[model samples]
Target: MNIDKPHAGNKFFLSEISFLGYVVTRGGLRPDLQKVDAVRDAPTPTSLTHVRAFLGFASYYRRFIKGFAAIARPLTNLLRKDQPLTCDGECERTFSTLKEALASAPILVRPDHGKPFILITEWQSEAISAILAQQGKDGREHVVEYASRTIPDERKNDSAPQGECYAVVWGIQHFHPYLYGQKFLLVTDHEPLLALKKLTNYTGMIGRWAVRLQEYDFDIVDRKAEKHGNADGLTRLHRPGKVPKGEEITSWKEPKQSEGLEYGQVAILPRT
Candidate 1:
């Protein structure tokens, strides 16, 4: 039998048979292949609307980008109230940079429940706050998420120490629902560490804020200024103007734990 030519009278049926045989023989039968849906083209975003759309998407994933809000400040300013602006060279540059940053931004990994989560909280001011979460394993740490916010003007100058305290309290409280039933560490350099339990006497808004912090299960560890260098770097990264290079300030002092062992002791052990 000549394989290239139809076998006989039933040409159409022979062609169908040949095609089916070729498909089955060349690509082994796969149930998943049968369920494969036809590929559909994604609609292209309009250039006029792409900026806004991409920025919104970037904002949604901002926690994955260090200094995101700070980096995008120039671009965000364009959307502010009564601001006369044009998407000129500077705007276009910022827009393009942001788009590129968004495209290359890393996906945030979920925190490991079996591991202790480290939160480095920074109060750039009473209202402007930031937190960097890192997971430790086999004696190393990697960032898991970055969170930062600027308090409304009404909240600034309220009491730097108390505000920082409240920020941590509220931050943990806000993130508690997701992190409930898990062990975590809080990092801060504020002197409030000596007076955290006395928050109720703080007075004014700070006093009210302190009441909410009493419910969380956490221990406040004082990060000496020298130890908190990396965390401080993260705070400076959120400051106005260009961000500097090098490792953001981070601290690794052992947190006091129950059972007469420090949290860092267990985490620093080599993984088998």
Candidate 2:
């Protein structure tokens, strides 16, 4: 094949480009050295305001910091209402750890829309978290993005299964800009979600969630809880809603078939 192009100021091929504090290269996206150095050289915070400032700056690169929420918990806790402003030893260590993590942050590759994405999600009483990643040509998963947030106090007491179910919906919606018209794989440690379509008596909330999920194209898979350490740590600080023992899901049954609609199938597989 032969290709020809007129010399143009805005159409020349280049090895890489810096955009939004990230360096986009042929291999992947990496944090800009200048930005990384700025965070690395930031002074220790003595006030809550300072702490928040630091966090706001560092957060832009949180995708490079695995277990980011867990690592920054000590610092974030100080921001709660009526909490003391003291920067304890733990907070100091967290600051240093965050700086170090940013300095050595991984380069996340731009996802190939043609490839299937793997979404990992976790749920705790106060938080829902997820990681968007994809398997590389080298057969290793590469990070694409990470998202997490605290649930409101009012809804914090939702049942464990419901919370898990919400994690699925929230994660997919969070990444809707990328997932809206694509097929991907959803991975979760919560078995209940994988079996959601099989539940004979689904809750109102679950029913609503299932309906919303129908718009997307994807597959759900169940993995062992122990293997989901990436998204797990983001929600570790929150207490988990408990499920009593012996509560077997005897109502498991296939979801009803809808005319003109095909539900995404759940695929159960052994751990690699």
Candidate 3:
């Protein structure tokens, strides 16, 4: 029972302590500044480590990049066990694209709970979705942020008019609790704004949805498809296969017959 003699159970613990002491005496716990600087200033990865670091940063801002996980699938495959990752032409292109996207990542401004939020949504036949949020302040409306995504094929064919409509509903639902009794505007390119007035029963899923929508006052306005060109392009970028360039060029024509709604005007309809 001598204190100098280590018990069998404590032998492993003593060994760990001895090793740690040796390490500490050999060098302080802090890393070598020169080595640390070398690592920091080291050439950016044109290889596996670079890809992983870029992916890590991309993940940090996943909200800004819709369908980010899906988009990075190919790059992630390079990180799997025993897999040889080569920075071939294709990988190099992707690496450059991701780095560019990361460098110029858009700064999203948080929504103001007090100001009215306007959501512009776009729906595509392919089940892609995009949304742009603008808030009214000081007698003017300015874009607060943007978000977009491509829904799984299975989920696309649902009764929802467009992926953007679903996206809009989801965004509003997310902010509903904070915005209860607050007024907001739902902007869409869909033509069925009048049909939404037919909603009466507030019980089933659709009804519940209507109820939640009703809680916070909202008016559906037609945002001409052409006007949302930028957002539409972003939604297409999330689409599953290669998307051709110049497909986003759209010409917005003035409505032939006007609802006569002026910009920034809100049209409120009586709840059905």
Q: Rank the candidates by lDDT, best first.
A: 2, 1, 3
RMSD from true fold, candidate 3 = 19.9
List runs of model 1 lying over 4 Å from the truth: 1-51, 84-107, 125-129, 132-134, 200-202, 224-272
Give one digit per residue, the lDDT tens place, for model 1 in 1-272. Answer: 67688567544432122332122222122111111111011121122233344456456556655556555655555544444323344554555565555445453455566677776666665233345465544564466666656555666665777567666865676567545676677788886665675655857666666676666556667888788654441112132222233312122234456523221111111222
lDDT tens per residue, model 3, 1-272 = 76788676654433122231111122112222332232333333333444555566455444454434445555665666544333344554555555445444444445667666776655554434344455544564454544544466566576654344465566665455544677767777777643454588766555555655565677878767787553461112122222233222122323356434332221222222
Model 2 lDDT tens row, 69-181: 76787777766755543455677789899989888888888888888889899887657788999998799888898777777667788998888888888889989988888
Candidate 3 matches the true fold with a TM-score of 0.49
Q: List the residue pairs that clash in candidate 2.
A: 198-253
CA shift of 172, model 1, Å: 1.4
> Looking at model 2, which ten-residue stretch has the lowest summed lDDT?
260-269
Q: How far is each candidate from the true structure, as Cα RMSD in Å?
A: 21.3, 18.2, 19.9
* TM-score of decoy 1: 0.55
- In order, candidate lDDTs are 0.50, 0.72, 0.48
